[model samples]
Target: MSARSLASPQSAGEQKKKLADSLIKKFNKKFNGPLNNPHLSSIIVAEVGKLLQKAKISPGDLEQVEAKISREAVSESSAVLRNEDVRLRKIKAEMSSKGGLPAALLSKEDRKILPKELKKTIASPKKKPAARVSVNMLENTVRARNAQLDKQKAKHTSVFSSLGMVGPATPDSDAGNILVGAKSLPLDQAVDPWSVLIMHDVKKYEDERKQREEQKRLQREQWKRELDDQVKINERKKKEAAMEEVKYAEEEQDQLRVADIQEKKKKEAKMMINTKLKEERAKTVAELQEQKRRQLEEQKEEEKSEVRRMEAEIARAERRQQRKREEEAERAKRLQEENKEQRKMREEERKKKHRMDLEYAASQARMLDDLERRRLEALGKIKEKMKTIEVMGDTLGHSILEKEEEDERRAEMWRQAYEKKQLKVCFFRVCWCRGACNVCVEAVRDRGGEMEKVN
Candidate 1:
């Protein structure tokens, strides 16, 4: 039987031991460190052993617990790493969003809200409108002209009064004159209510024009402030982007190093596994060869045993045949002696029977002779009667003659029938006697032959 067939199934402890051994080998080959550093395999193995001993756990249960812990640890670690990667990626995206080109470096197309035409207009340099003519100066010039007109009118009214050529002036006329004067005077100097209303309208118009110019000036200043802020923000973003690029390059280098290490470890592991498989296959082949040799030996022994058994059986069969032949010879001798006495008695009986048959044959021959003589005498009597009938047939009438002839013929026929019957009986009796004599003679000859053999 094979060792595997003889042994029980491997226990958890044994499996664990095998796993540990494999792990130790893998670690010894995989770990790369300072020459003075302790081997990773020894440290890991010792730590795990110490932990398991402290737990005082059974191997079977420990295996299950270890497997569960390993799965959970791997899952948790992977989840954490995945979350960290996601967070880092989100931060990188935010940083990229914050970083942008400064206005000085940006193209018109890059401006988010500004149209190309507007950007061009803004870029083109133009002289500021020389400080807008102040509305107050225009108001002052209008007041001075109104004062000179009022003075010339007053002087002309006085000269007309002195010449006494004044016509009847009613109150209505005076009111009309005051209205005309109010229309020409400045708002501050005017006494008429209409003059004040007209002056209020002129001032309101001037104030509205000044308000529009101030709004335009404020808009220009706001645009300048926004552009400055944008430039500062762009500069900051550029600096941050440069820093991020350097950080990303360093991370990529680290990842490449890690990947190279992992690849080397995988190659080493694959080589170790291949070597182990080859060793196992060779060991299995040797075991199979051993089993085959054992089977061949067993077959050869069985064949030799079978040959011995067959030879023994053949010998027994031959002996049985020899014994059977000897028994048959003895029985045949006894039967021969018994047959000798039987043959003597049979000879005596056959001789007596032959004598009786001879006597019977002699009597039968005498009887046959007697019957022949009687038959011949009857035929002679029949012939004589036929001659007599023939003689009487001539004397009788023709009919009577015919009757006699028929009678005679009938009588002759009857006589001939009787002779034939008697001859047949005699012939049969003679044949029977001859046959009995022949049988007795043959029996007597056979007995004589047996007697000679016995002598």
Candidate 2:
């Protein structure tokens, strides 16, 4: 039966009452009929009531059971729908591989209609491709649907214009009038039913598409701004790094230059010190050599003076010995002359004695007296000689004193002469000397007590 016919109020109520009355009449007739068994009928009626009561109880229990079963069935059906959704997606993949229609348009049971629709769409020349009803198509459909909306908007604008307001009517402006008109007219009054449905879906689809497009544009702008900021940051870092490198290089170069200058200065200072030291050492060596030469000359002069003094002493001793020998020879000659005189006198006396005794005796007496006088004279002479010797000794002492004084005067003269000779020699040596010899000469002249001459 048609669902509408079964649900009609008058038919549903009348059918329920007639079924109830028929069941009651069947019970009464069965008891009052030819069977006419009262006890049996009563038992049957009681059994029927009991059966009704049982039936009612059974119905109530069945209703409770059915509700529980229905809840379980509904949960199982939902599970089945979820499983079917998965199966449908898999089938969609297979069908898409075979270039069939999209599976999104069909429910689990309705998917069977998809093949028939695809067949019809492909076989009938009048049938459009499903792609014609896609987002792009829906956009176009929305644009066409807006034509009728535009007419309604124009009508609303006219109503507003009658009130003397400016421009067209807005959505917030009296949609009450449009709502009343929309309610009074059937849904398909102004447009084909299918077209009205399509237009409505198209409008909703276009609005969602616009909102998604705007979101994407905003995201693209945000990404672009981030990229620009990163580029600027990288550029700044590169510049800073390059500057730091340059600064470090400059510092290194400066340090190298300073080191080079210091090295050069050190070398110069060392060279100057060495040169000064060498010059001072040479001067000291020259002075030492000059001093040694002067000392050697003094030593030679001292040796010569010692030799001269020794020779003078030896000559003075030899002269003293020769003077003593001459004195002794003179004394021996005087004694020999005296001895010859005395012997001649004695021989003459003997000859006189023999010639005349008496006469001779008187003569002899006179001669004896003369002889005695001569002897006395000789003794006085001897005494006078002794006195002369004493006088000579005194004279010799005076001579020795005179000689010593002369020697002292001579020695002083020699010393003065020797010093003069030394001065002359030193002058000559100085005039002839070369190089540093002038300094040696100056020193010698100072030592010789001739500094005034040098000045």
Candidate 3:
């Protein structure tokens, strides 16, 4: 039982190792090998150079170090090229021996040999220092001046403490005189002009250092971003490969299913063909028998139909004769009815004509009566006007010639009015009469002209 337990663990480890090896092989094949970013190596070399410069290494030492590094790199590259196959075998053997240890559990040298992107994930990233607060150059100058002043004051105090006499009442040197004057002024104005240059140089150096630090920070961030991008690209490629594999598997399954369905369809088609052939044959025999039977039945039916056709023809002839007789009798009756309707219509037309003639006569009589009455009334009105004119002439003592002229004028007006009235009556009559002759229109026009002349 102890042996079995030990063997089981070994077997499980072997299985895991096999699984890991297969997975690694698949990953290598899918990725077409590990990443080889030339830029990353160049950046690392540049960073090393920057650190060496920061260390203030001598030019001779730098040259020697560079030469050694170059020789090593060339030798290492050649060795790697020469031992690639051996290296692969060794790696396989190691993996087999290790029994499924992960890449992270490998040694530091092994981790260094891994891809840069993978190394980033296997190792913890260094935490960047917080950025330093920037001080204004004027503020720094003021602070430096204050510190120098404080140190000078402390020295003076110490010197005075050691002396038996009190401090000097006034300064004698030019610097002492300037300091005495500066002491009376503000701190900003009291700044030593000589120190400005030193402060400026120090500020310049600080700015350069900050700038270099910022540049290094930016480069690091950019490198990290590029690494992240590479990782993402690898992940996307892996996903795409997995999807393609699934698609290929599904396509293979579909091809197999299609083949199976085609085979089944071919088998079913053969069965259906055989069944159709038998059915067709049986149907042909049955159809031949039915055809003979239908032919005999058709012959008997044709004979009966012939007899029935003769009887139907005789009956149709008799029906046609009877229909013709009935049609003739009905047509005669209809003609007699139409003649009666025509006679009644003629009588109605004649009566309508008589009524119309009477209505026309009555209208004509009414028109004539209205014309006569208007004429009589006009004449009476003219006579009354004439009599009034005659009376006026007599009352005003008019002469016979004036009265005669007045009488002539009155007669002319009466004649014009009468002619205008006659013309209007003629125009109305012409309008009332349908299709009035042109002669009547011309006469009325002539009367209108004459009346207009008189007016």
Question: Which candidate number has the best lDDT?
Answer: 3
Candidate 2 off by > 4 Å: 1-195, 312-455
**Candidate 2 residue pairs in clash (backbone atoms < 3 Å):** none
Report lDDT (Cα) of residue 376, candidate 3: 46
Q: Where is model 1 poorest over a 10-residue stretch in terms of lDDT?
A: 424-433
Tell me the lDDT of candidate 1.
0.45
lDDT of 3 by residue, 1-455 (tens): 12233234456656444633553343223221222224334433453445334323333343333333333333333333334334434544565465433443455434433344444443433332322222344466556655765666665652222112134532321234333322244334444643665666568767866975675566445544543454455455445445544553564466456546756865885687578658856975886698679758966885686587976677576785687589669967976896687688667856865886687557645744663464345335434533653464353332334434644564465346546665233332222121133333454566664211110
Better of 1 and 3 by TM-score: 1
Residue-by-residue lDDT tens digits, candidate 1, 211-234: 756755664455445544544544
Ranked candidates (TM-score, high to low): 2, 1, 3
> Compared with the true structure, what per-residue lDDT tens digits does model 2 show for residues 1-455?
12244334676557544634554455435323322335444543444444334322332232232223223322332343344345545554554465443222233343332333332322232311121234344456557755755677666634323222244445644433333323233323443334556777679756865875675466445433433453454455445435544553564466456546756865886687578658866976896699679868966875686577767667665675586467557746654664465456445644543443566346535744663464345335434533653564455444445544654564465346546765333332222121123344454555765432331
All candidates: TM-score: 0.23, 0.27, 0.21
Overall lDDT per candidate, in order of appearance: 0.45, 0.45, 0.46
Model 2, position 147, has a per-residue lDDT of 72
